[model samples]
Target: MSESAQAADPVAYIQHHLTNWSTSQPKSIADFNVLHLDVIIFSALLGGLLIFIAKKIGENLSLDNPSKLQSVAEMVVEFVNDQIKNVFPHPDKLIGPLALTVFVWVLAMNAMDLLPVDLLPSLWTGILGLFGADPSHVYLKVVPTTNLDTTLGLALCVFVLILAYNFKSKGPMGYLKMFLFHPFGKFFIPVNIVMTTIEELAKPLSLGLRLFGNLFAGELVFLLIALLTLGAGFSFGLFIWFPMQVLLDLAWLLFHLLVITLQAFIFMVLTIVYLGMADATADDH
Candidate 1:
């Protein structure tokens, strides 16, 4: 939209910032075919960046005198490993690395919220405009965790791991039996099946929604704060509102650093707990 138009409509400004740059226009709000390009791009970039950093750090390993980056990396690995040991004492070889990746990746994506809301999107819009694309049509949301598709995609991966662990711990027949005779035993098979199904489904649902809701709300607050200077011209309002806007943004940014880290930790821990539960045999249960 034109600057004046956006200034006149605060809702449009907020909506423009919230919308994701996608491969195609969605038919409805929940169109599966509508691929969110921004989320995929940012997520892949962040993952690749992490892998690159790890590889570089590994190649430069020096026990005699570790670099600051290497020291930080070791601390993160130890922290994640400690969390895994707490939940799954006999965790699989993959669990430690997986938990570390999830925590770091989620934390990195969540950290995108700390960026100025208009920075990347505005830069992207300018680049697209140079290529003859309409500036108004350019919507780039940097934080992947704020997108439901990204969060649910991560949750579904955990769900698959849960299923795999269950099948490995118990044979197929034993896993099936869990659905049939869980709480009340085979006497209440029907009720048991229904209850077990809901319980199983809720794991991924909760994981995805919890992460998405928190990040989305945090992003929304940043956007709302951005709106404070929306139409503030070179008048008395600009001086009054701009300082307040800066103060609010700084306060929220400090608090959100904790929120992002905690959210990542929560997700990683729950993943470990669920996988640990899946490893339990019928007798253990």
Candidate 2:
């Protein structure tokens, strides 16, 4: 943590921060990704917290002058409800709640960026080391959106929901019939199948990659700011260094909160929209 200590092991320190706490190495080069334990635990915990808040909001509904919590809840609920109404018709039964929960949970997960970048991961690694593992080998990335595993896991969840809606809205035969017949007609079943497969693959891949790309960029920016702060006085002749670092970090942190919320909202809404498309009775025919 000291300047000399950091200088002595620059690459090692940076590499340690970059590594993930994973179960094991994946099978191949294509499967090289390992899980980030911090992302998984915190994201799930935030999701549960979101659900708890939603439940509490439902319990303490007041029709008069809305309290601060109620107002916030109303705004989010109304936003999701409006989107559901506009995009997915007859969606009162399920899409409303689904959209609401997805938005809240995704936002909560993204909000993990509000924590100082290395704090959680450092603490986590230390705790893991106490159980006899090597501290250097204990790697964890706290930013869920920065990790492909985190985004892909969420995208996979959306995939499952889309599949469920497909089956629910249309029987197995109806669902198959859409790809097998509707789009390109009977003569081009092969082509239609390929197109459909691409469409399906694109959903999760795009969804995950979109979130991953944005968050990863934001994280890189933060890291760059950190490096600047570290190299400030030594490189820049000890000029109003700490204050400048604080200001820069503050500005970026403020901007990143907006980025985090927007990215989460977009991911959730896109997820709902995609699933709604699958539930489209018109599209199936």
- The top-ranked prediction according to lDDT is 1
Q: Model 2, 4-70: lDDT tens per residue?
A: 3543565555656666666775575347465556667878777788778777977888898667998
Candidate 2 has its poorest 10 consecutive residues by lDDT at 228-237
Candidate number with greatest TM-score:
1
Candidate 1 lDDT, tens digit per residue, 78-191? 999899878884748889889999999999999999999999998998888899988778899999999999999999999999999999988799899999999899899999
Model 2 CA deviation exceeding 4 Å by range: 1-11, 25-35, 123-135, 231-241, 282-285
lDDT for model 1: 0.92
lDDT of all the models against the reference?
0.92, 0.75
Question: TM-score for each prediction?
Answer: 0.97, 0.83
